[model samples]
Every structure is written in structure tokens, then in C-alpha cells.
Target: MTDRLKLMQGNEAVAEAALAAGARFFAGYPITPSTEIAEIMAARLPAAGGRFIQMEDEIAGISAVIGASLAGQKAFTATSGPGFSLMQENLGFAAMVEAPCVVVNVQRLGPGTGIPTAPGQGDVMQARWGTHGDHPAVAFCPGSVREAYDLTIQAFNAAERLRTPVILLLDEIVAHMREGVHLPPPDELVIIDRPRPAGPPGSIGAAPAYRPGKGEVPAIPDFGTGYRFHVTGLVHDETGLPVNDSRVADGLIRRLHRKIELARREITFTRACRLEDAQVAVIAYGSAARSARQAVREARERGVQAGFLQLQTIWPFPAEEVANLSRRVPQLIVAEMNLGQLEAEVRRAVSGKAEVIPLTSGGGRLFTPEEILGAICTAPGGRLKKVVHQ
Candidate 1:
């Protein structure tokens, strides 16, 4: 791929990447830290022969995206804390009905508008569990401006290939950061559109439109594409009718999860340095991982065998990888801007095979490399200096 450098903000790069990924429709309400994404799409989508709509609210925004996806258009939306909160139900609806779309949440400090412009990794858990029930989610977290663009394209690809709602969770630091990025030529980038049926439409020989595809994903015929199918939140069979029978519901739920769960390696991506030969390892994602990487390097320079694991994919947490890393490293440092969310998951995965130490700050400030290295300096006996900033 030939290099074409562009001075772009992370949010703008994401919007450009979305267009390159063939996102023809965008429906979203303006929200702080993420409104630039909507603004860019509004201006450029029509020029690309696509559609963009500023909806009434976050809920309606996602609702329209879901409808567009069912109509066989690649769709997306962007939001922040409160707007992300408002999107939960429709997010679930998209998951339940097997709609493919992307949702970007540029996070801010929150539990109810604690801070708007400040950075926080508070929405990590919400990206996975904000929606109700036992639905599966594939969420990506990018740590740099370049990664923000690259991962946004991957997010759209995952949504198209898996037939599920994919979330790109970005902290304010990564969302608003401006830097030079070498973007590849649009034609050189591999664009995977949603797969279409092979056979001719409605002749003597044709497969049922509702037939389950790979990963138990139902093959949806685009609206007005001659084939019609039903969609509902209720647990249904291949035909998509509401069903209450216990066995039927159980099978339906399994299919929904299989799309994301069954292809773990394909969907999960991470960056690790010196992990195989390290005694101490730090695990982090989003902006927190940026500091974690620097801290690990500084610790290694101080004659400590330190490693860093940066998560590019946050959801469907890499259980097998985390479990194996647990037995290898004597101490695992789980760092975050929020209060110990991924730490709990790592602890459970490690299962006491190694010491699980958490480095956290919830008052919206990101962890510095010194702060993380401090945790590394003081071990089982020493407390993490200022675990909560507030």
C-alpha cells in the first residue's frame, strides 16, 4: 500500500474510514467529542452517493441505522456518554434481529454527565452490557489517532462479516487527538461488503431466504429485493416468528452468540511486547494502554522484566489468552481509567495463578507512565498509589 499522509483528528479519520468501508448510511444525533464524526459524514456521504440523517435522539439514531442495514445498506452512528446510554435498547434490537451496523462511542467522564470534555474509559463495561439480556457484542478500542482510523474500518468489516452490531469505543483522548497518519489508497484497502446470495432470484431453483448461513446467521434478503423475511426481538426460528417454547428460545440465543463467539481468533486482536519472557505484565486498552506501554518500557530499562498487552479488541474478552498469560507472568497489572472493570475479568481468568494488581483512576484523568511504573515498583505489600483519583 502506498503511503498518503494526512493531518487528521482521530474523529475525522474515523469518518473517512467509514466512507472507505462502504458505509452508505449514517443516522445519529450530535454529541460532544463525537459530533465531528456525524458532521463529516453529513457532508461527504451525499457526495459519495449515500445518505445521512440527523435523528431526534440517540435511540432514533440507532433505530434508523438498524432499518437501513435491514434494507441492505452499510450504516453507522456516533455518540458519547449520555447518548450511548440512550442507545442501549436499539443496540439490543440490532443484535436480536441480526442487523449489521457500526456504533462509535467517544467516551467522556460519566455516570450521569460527570464531565463532558474530559477523557475516561468508563464505558468499557457499558459497551458490552449496556444492552439487556444474553446478547453477544464485538467492541474495538483504539489507542492512537492512526489506530482510530484503522480500527473503525475493522469495526465496519466485523459488522458486515458477522451480521452483528459492532462498537468502536474511544476515550476522549484518542477521539480528539490530532496526528499525522499515512492512510492507504482506498482501492488498495480490502473492502468486504456483506455477502449476497449466489443463486438467481425466485426461479425454479432457489434457496429459502431465511436459510441459516455460516455461524448460524440468517441470510437476510435486502428490503425490496424480491425476497421478504420477518424480523423481531422475540426468540424465533429460521423464519423469524416469535416463539416462547423453551427449547426454541434456547437454540435461537445460541445462534445469535455463535456469530461472534464461534470466531474468536478472527475477531480478537491485541498487541503485546516482551510478554513471553516477562515476570511482570501490564494489561490495558484505549488511552490507558498508551501509558501502560511507556511504563513497561521504562520498567524494563530499570532492569525489571516487564511486558505490555494492549487490547485492540475489548469485547469477547480473550479468555484463553489471558488465562495462559496468567500462568506465565508472576504479576499481572490491570490498568484502566475506570474503577477496575477489566481487572475483575483478568482476575477471574487468572484464577489466582498469579498476583492480580489493579491500577485505576476514575476522576477522568488518564494514568501516567510513572503512576503505572509505581505500581510495578511496589508489589504485593505496597498499595497502588492513589487507586482512585477522586
Candidate 2:
């Protein structure tokens, strides 16, 4: 453990984890809080017999990643808020074509570059619905550098397994923070490559490239691998060719959503601290969870039964977990770096079962433990009654 331990920043952990997960191609533009990831990939990928390219912009970056992934290279890209917005079109394209790729978004304060060096969780809703049209999304948000490494690999695994784009959402605070991480040995890592075609169900002939197998995932072969197939962003049939029929379009889109919706339980990752028997609970993710964790500990020290729930997966939102926690506790506090983006979702999940309180910051700063502890100690009745804007 000691030998594998290293002091690494969150961005560095993500880059290393992608490599460990078999990523061989990275194409991204440098953006604050996320540039380190691209830099590390650029510096280290070539030596690992991998390839790295700095694209002119975020749009091109994600497009290149999709192309590389289709070409059979485990590929990814990195960006912050503004860049993430630019890549939305291509991100949707990747989802439509069932391309396996990972997009690391180190979120900074934004609505047109609000603040590059500041942290914000405002993109929670955007990450889930930024792209046009209806499409399934898989995204992970890590609360620490260690989780950053672990979840980065999980992101790639999910992308490959689902044959869809995955988002690794980070905030500026976590991206820049350094922590001592004990990386797992390479042998212990569970790496999963996308399923390849083995011909159709019977007959022993080539399988339809976009045909759905178990879990609605298609075993599309890699480009240039001698298997003839087509990949397109437009609605298509099982053969991967574009089709204009409403029935074909409807079925294809629904199946794409079904692949992820059915796997919701498997994709959602969460950590709860002392939530088993608590009078009050705090739900948070990313950097905000760090402070929330500290606050939970201090609340217990002061004889308050405060629990903490940290969301490691942001998209395909953990509505069930939040709903369950709401039924258990009379009050739930949601701490985040945005203006209640996820707080709204928690309210919808709780469905009036509990009083949902929001402790939010407007980016650039983080909540101190005392801030969250105050909210926990002052819950409704005698506790919190309104949003606590930090």
C-alpha cells in the first residue's frame, strides 16, 4: 500500500486512471481546471504506445474522441464548463451512434465563462440534458482524488459496456486539490472491453452491427477491422444504416434509452456515513461532499444524529436513494456549489416526505464545515426552515 501511494491532484488521478483502464487515445483542448488532464495525457500517452492530440477547440476535441473510439482505440477528452457546452453536439452524436468514449468535465463557474478558476456544480442539469433531443446519459461525479481515479475507470467501463458516451464531472475545487491516494495494483483492476460481434443469433453469419443483444447493447465491431458496417448520427435500423421510418426511429431511440435506464442500479454509486439511524441527513456530491462529510462528523460530535449521503454518480440521478433517505429522515439538507440545480431534483425525489434544505454557494468558494453544521443543527421545527445561501 505504501509503495503504491502517491500524492496526486484530482485531474492527475483521472488521467492516470484512464490510462489504467486501457485508454490509448486522447484528443482535447486545454481548459482551466481540466487542462492538467490533457497535459498529463499528452506527456505520458505517447510513451505508453498511445496517441494524444490537442484539438483546436472543444467541439473538435470530442469529435476526434468519437472517431478514435469507433476506430477501436479506447479514447477520451477533457474540458470545463464552456468547453463542455461546445462539445454537446458531438456528445449527442456519440450517444446516437453508440460510440464508446469518456468526456472529463472539470466544471468551473459558468454561463459564458463566469469564472475559470472557480468551482461550481451548476452543470448538473446541463450534463444530463445539455444535448438536444432525447438520449440516455451516464455520468459520474467523484468526491475525492481517490474516488476520482476509481470513478474515471468506471466511466470508461460504463462507456464501453453501454456503447455510449460517459461523463466524468469534476468541480474546480476537486480538480485542483491534492490528496495522498493509494492506487490499486494493475492486476486487481477490472477492465471491460466492449463486446465484439460474433455473427447473428443463429446461422453463423455476420451479426447486424447495431443489433441489440443482452441489455440492449449492440456489439458493433471496430472500424477497419474487416467487418463491413455503417455508423451514423441519424436514426437508423439494426444494420446501422440511416432510416427515415418513424417506427424504426422510435424503436432505435427507445432502445438506446433502455440500455441505460435498465442499468440504473448498476450505474449509480453512492456512499453513506452514519445514515442508518439518523434524525437528519445531508446529501451532496463532488467537492461539496467533502465539506458535507466534515460537517456530518462534527454534528455527531455535538450529539446530533446527522448523516451524510455522497453521490458518486450524478446522471441517471439517484432518485431512489434520495427518496429512501427522505422516508427515513424528517429533514434532508442538500449542499452544493450551484444555485440549487440538484436541490430541485432532491425535492422531486423526496416528494414532500421530508423537508429538503439547500445550502449553496455561488462558486469561487467552498462551504466550511461550520456552515453545513449550522444548517444541520438548525433543522425545521427547531431545524432549517429555508435555503442557506453561503
Candidate 3:
């Protein structure tokens, strides 16, 4: 590991990592808890010959980023709360068109700009299903400044490798927290480049022409190239033209789902600490995972057989690992900053094999160590009691 460390805010680290990952375009509107990312990108991206645009609104910002990405430049945008809501339409468009780009959502309390500057993990489920339809997108969360850097690069890599929009889900606390992060040496990082077309530039003879072979991710031809293709929200065939036929719709939909689901092995990552012989496991992610880690350590010190499963990838849910752990452990506590979003998934995965408990709080607050321990103490059959807040 590189020993050189400097104190950096999470948003700064994300902007720095995007630049290092070869992202050359950023377009976003200013929003609290995430504006720092845009500010840094505007200043720093120019230094690296990258383009930055501060658009009028979040919708335009994401639309511009998608446009840039289709032009063969890695692109990104950042927002929070209401801004994130504004970007949903374009985000859905990006997913539908298979536009590869990165979107950083520094989440704040919300239903409608609920708390712009306060920390909250309320966007966990939104990150998965905020966009319409059955489109699958990869979403990752970073609990620390170092992970803000690492996962941002991973988000870009995932977008290019899968030819889809990838979301970097960060809460207000993680986005604002300043911590020492050791910058990695340039040569040690692995960066992914998008697939390129195999044949000569204008080899495809017809309009809306392209080939994405069976079980293979297609190379996206950049716009401004001689080869013309259609981009739209409507279901389209492999050639990129809108098709109203059911067969074409079915194939397109299945491919979109399969392409992401089949790549789960590459997308899923989680940390299991002291789970080998534990009887109780705490499932957590994002900044909430930080508190859970501390709680688990303290629980272990008190002779409790507690362990932690810290998720790095939020979407796709790591079901297999969660199921296996659920079976091994007698009780499972799903701690999140939302009201049981992930806990529901944990219950489905375990299938009643273990006692599933939810410890959640919303509106810009986190579950503290003492609160977690209290949950542990009050667990029925040694499992935490489900606490619901309306």
C-alpha cells in the first residue's frame, strides 16, 4: 500500500479519481453535499484538458454527460436530493440507450429537498429502482474517503465494461467527511477502456448499423463518426433503431437484464469480518457500515459472537453470500440509514432460516454504536428487535 497520505474530503477524492481514471467530461448543476464534486471537477478537469460544463439543471447535466459519453469520452455528473430527482429522466434514458457513464449521487435527506445539507442514506433503494422499467444498473457505495476514490474508478470501469450507466451512491456524511487517503501510484491502478469496433471505420453498409455479437458486449461507435445510429428511450434492436415489435422488445429487454445479471461476479464486492465462527452477523453498507464495524468490534470485546458484512456493491445485493451467511449465523441484523430497505432483501435471501432484524433510521441520522448494541441486547432469540419509524 502507498504510505503517502493526505487529508481529503470525499467529494474531492471522487473528483480526483475520476480524472485519474481518464474521464474527460463532467457536466452537472450545483447542489449541496455534492456541489464540491462539481466545483473540483470544473477546476481540475480543465487542467487535464478535460471538459466541464455547469448546466442550468440536473436534467441537462446528465443529458450532457450521456451525450459526451456517446462521443467516446468517459463522462460523469454529481447531484443531491432534488437534483438527483431531476436527473432521473435522463438517467433512465442513458440506461435505455446503453450509454456508458458515471453518476455520483451524494445523498441527503429527502422526499423533496427534505434536508439538503444533512446526511442521510435514504437513497439506497432509489439508486436501484429510481429509473423506470426493468433496466439493470450497477450501484456502489463508499464508506470512506479512500473508497470514494477507489469506487469512483470502479464505477467508471463498470460503466465501460458493461456499456451501462453506473451509480456511485454516497451519503452526505461520507461526501463531506475529511480523512487521510493514501493516493495510489499511477501505474498500479487498472483502468478499463470501452470496447472498439472490429472492422474498418465505415465498413457497416447501412444506417442504424452495428454488430454486438452473441454473448458479447458491443463496441459503441462514437458519435460524429461516419457510422450513424439511433439513440432513444424506446425499445431498440441491436442495430440501435426503435422497434415496436414484441420479439425485438423481448430480446432487447432480456439482453439488457442478462448482460448485467451475468456479470454479477464481476460487480459484487463485500467485506466479511470475523464471520467465520460467529453466530450473529450485522449487515450494513455506506457510512452506516462504519458505525456497524465499530459496534461489531465492541460486541466481540464483550464476548458476543458478532461479525459484520460490509457491502461495497449495493445493487444486485450479493444474495448468494448473504444467503450462505444467513444460514451459518443464527441471527442477522440489517442496519441501514433507511427504514428497512435492505432488511427486506436480507429476509428474502435468508428465507426464515435465521432471525432477520432491521435497525433503521431515516431523515438524516445514523444508527450509533450504543443504539446498535442496544438493539443487540434487545434482540429476540439473541436477534435485534425490528424498530419501525413512521
Name the top TM-score candidate.
2
Candidate 3 global lDDT: 0.85
User: How do all the candidates rank in terms of TM-score, highest first?
Assistant: 2, 3, 1
Error of 3 at 186 (Å): 1.4
Q: Give the Cα lDDT of each candidate.
A: 0.86, 0.90, 0.85
The residue pairs that clash in candidate 1, if any, are none
Each candidate structure's TM-score, on Cα atoms with residue i matched to residue i, is 0.94, 0.95, 0.94
Candidate 1 stretches greater than 4 Å from native: 1-4, 203-206, 380-390
Across 1-390, the per-residue lDDT of candidate 1 in tens digits comes to 856567889899899999989999999999988989999999999999999999999999999999999999999999999999999999998898888999999999988987898999888899989999999989999999889988988999889888899999998989898888888778788777775566557753335554667766666767777764578888876666777899988887787787777778987889999886788899999989999999888987876778888989989898778888888888898999989888988888899998999888984788999999898777642223344666
What's the candidate order when arranged by decreasing lDDT? 2, 1, 3
For model 2, the local distance difference test gives 0.90
